[model samples]
Target: MIRITDNEFDKLASYIQANYGIFLKKEKQALVTGRLQAELVQNGFKNFSEYFEYILADTSGSAVTAMINKITTNHTFFMRESEHFDFFQSEVLPFLHSTVRNNDLRIWSAGCSSGEEPYTLAMILDEYFGNEKGTWDTKVLATDISTKVLDTAKSGIYSNDKVGTMPTHFRAKYFRRMDEKSSVIHDKIRNEVIFGKFNLMEERFPFKKKFHVIFCRNVMIYFDEKTKTELVNKFYDFLEPGGYLFIGHSESLNRETTRFSYVKPALYRKK
Candidate 1:
C-alpha cells in the first residue's frame, strides 16, 4: 500500500473541497494516492507534496478539476435500485400530472455519471406517456462534476457490458446496437435529456425553476457530515414543495436541518 503522509492528505483534501464539494476523509488517503498516482507521474511530480504544491499554485487550472474527477467515484449503472424508477412511474408521475397545471415535468439527475441514470429515467418517462409526446413536456437534467464522464454521456454510446443489467425489451426499444459490442441511445429518447458539467459545491444552482424530483443517489458517501448536511439542505431548497429527493440507499440526511420528510428508506420529500 502506498502511504500518503498527513500533510499530503490535508493539502489534497483542501484543494478538492475548495474546487469541488467533495470531502476527502482520512480513510480515503490510500484511495486518493492510488487513483492520482498516474496524474502525479504525468505531471512529473515525485510525491504527493510536490503535486499538491503545483495544484495549489495554479488553483484555477484544469488540474484541480481533473484531480477531483479522478478521485471522486462515478460507479453507476442502468436501473440501479429499480424501485426508484417504479416509484417515479407509478407514484411521482401521476402526482405531478394531477397537481401541476402544465404537463411539463422536470427531473434532475444530480451526479449523473456516464448518462446511465438519466437515460434510464428518460426511457421510463417515454414508456409511461406512450405516444402523447406533444401533450407533455418531459425531460431530464443530468449533471456531474466530471467533464470526462459528461463527454462520454453526450456521445450516447456504451459497451454491451454497461447495458447488461437492462431488460432486453427495453434495450431493444430505446437503444440501437452501434456495433458488435456497443450500443447507442436512440435519438428519440436521447434528445429528451440534457447533459452538463456541474460541481455540486456551488452555493447556487443555475436554474431558475425548481425540480419536481431530484435523484442524487450514491454520491453523498464521499462527503463528511457537514458537507452532507449542507447538500441535503440545498437539495431541499432546489426542489419544489412536495417534490421528491432520492438519495443513495446508504445515505441519510440529518433530520433536524432538512425539511424533507421520509417517504421511503433513503428517500425524502420536501415539506
Candidate 2:
C-alpha cells in the first residue's frame, strides 16, 4: 500500500485547494494514495512529499491535473436526473425561446468531465428543437479543471460502456459508431459544444456574455462551505436573471447562498 503521511496529505490538500478549489479531506489520504501511486512511480517520486514538492515547484504540472482528475469523482451520465431535463424542456427552454431575441441558447456545463454531460445536453437540445441541422445558433460551453478530461471531451468519442445511460433513440440519432467499441458524437451535436479548461476557483470569468443554463452538478461537494458559497455566487453572477442552475441531486444551496432560489430538489433559479 502507498503511504500518505499527515504532512504529505496537508501539502497535497492545500495545493489542490489553491489550484482547483477541491478540498481533499483527511479520509481522502488513502484515496489520494490509491489514485496517484502509479503517477508518482512513473514520475520517479519515492513518496507523497516528493510529489507534493514537484507540484509546488510547478503548479501547471500535468501531475496536478492528473491528480485532480483521479481524486475528483465524476459519476454522471446522460440525463442522470431526468426531472431536470424535463423541467428544462417543459419550463426553461420555452421561456427562453420566447423572451430571448436571438436564436442562440447558451449553456455552461461547468465541470463537464469526459463530455457526457454536455453532449447529453446537446442531444436533448437537438431532439427538442430540431436544430441539429445547424440552422440555429445554439452552443454549450463545457469546462473542467482537468486537461485530461477536457481532451477526452473534445475528442467526442466514447466507449459503448460510457454511453450506456443514453437512450437507444438518441444513440441512434445523434451518434455514429466509430469502431467496434466506441461511438463518435455526430458533427451537428459535437459542433454545438465547446470544451475548455477552467478552474472554478478563478476570481472572475472573462466572458462578456452570460449563460442561460449552468450545469454544475457533482462539483460543489468537493468545496468547503465558504468556497461553495463563493462559487454559487459566481455562478449566479454568470447567469442571466431567471436562468437556471442545475446542481447534483445530493447538493443544495440552502445554506450556501441567497443569490438563487431553490425551484426544485436540486434545481435553482437566479433571483
Candidate 3:
C-alpha cells in the first residue's frame, strides 16, 4: 500500500469536509491511509495528491464517486433503531394519514446507505397504508453521496446476514429468496423507494416541495458541530410545518441552538 504523507492527508481531509461535510480528525489519518492506499497503488497513483488532482479534472464524475464510496462509511442494517420505526408507525403515520390533504406522503432517507433505512421506511409505509397505498403517493426519496452504494440499493438485493435482522414475517412478506445466501426485495417494496446521489454540503437543497418526515439517521455523526448545525438547519427549512426529523440514537442537537422542538431522544419536530 502506498503511504499518504501528512500534506496529502490534510489536503484530502479538507476536500472531503468542504465538499461532503465529513470531518476527518487527526486520528483518522490512519483510517484514511488504509482505506485509500490500496486503490491509489492499484490505479498507479504514487500519492493522494495525484489521485485528487485527477478526481478534480475528471468531468465524467466516476472518479469522484469512487473516492467517496471508499472514504465514506456505509455500515447499516434493516430495522436500525427499531424504536424510531415504531414511533413512525404508531404515532407519526396516523398523524400524516389524517393531516396530509393530497394523499401524497413525502419521506426522505437522506443518507440511505445500501437501501436498508429507506427499504425499512418503504416497508413500514407499505404495511400501514395497505390497500390504501394505491391511492396515495408514498414514494420515499433515498439519497447518498456514494454511487456505488446507490447502485447496490437500486439492485434491492441483500446478503442473508443483512436480511436476517428483520422478523420472519417481514422476511416472508416483503422479500423473495434470490438464492441460498441472499434475498431480493419484493417489487411492491422496491418500487416505493427512489434512490439518487446527493451531497449534503451543496450550497442549496434543490427540492421544491417540503417533506412530511425526514429520516437522516446516523449520517450526521461524521460531521462536526458547525457542519452538523448547518445541515440540521437546512433540514429544518425543507420540512413542512409539523413534520418530524429522526436522527441516530447516538447523535444529538443542542436545543438552545436549533430551531427544532425537542420531541424525544434523537427525534425533533418542526413546530
Local accuracy of candidate 3 as per-residue lDDT tens digits, 1-271: 6777889888888988998999999999999888887678878998788998988898998887788888899999999999999999999999999999799899999999899999999999989999998999999999999998999999999998899999888999999988999999999888999999999899899998999999999999999999999999999999999999999999999999899999999999998
What TM value does model 3 have? Answer: 0.97
- TM-scores, one per candidate: 0.94, 0.92, 0.97
Worst 10 residues of 2 by lDDT: 129-138
Ranking by TM-score: 3, 1, 2
Write down the lDDT of every candidate, Cα atoms only. Answer: 0.86, 0.83, 0.92
Please write out the lDDT profile of model 1 over residues 126-168, one tens digit for every residue. Answer: 8888887659888899999888899889999999888878999
What C-alpha lDDT, on a 0 to 100 scale, does residue 68 get in candidate 2?
Answer: 74
Models sorted by lDDT, best on top: 3, 1, 2
Q: In model 3, how large is the Cα lDDT of residue 45?
A: 92
Task: Return the clash pairs for model 3, or none.
Answer: none
Better structure of 1 and 2 per TM-score: 1
State residue 256's C-alpha deviation in candidate 3, in Å: 0.6
Superposition error at 259 for model 3 (Å): 0.6
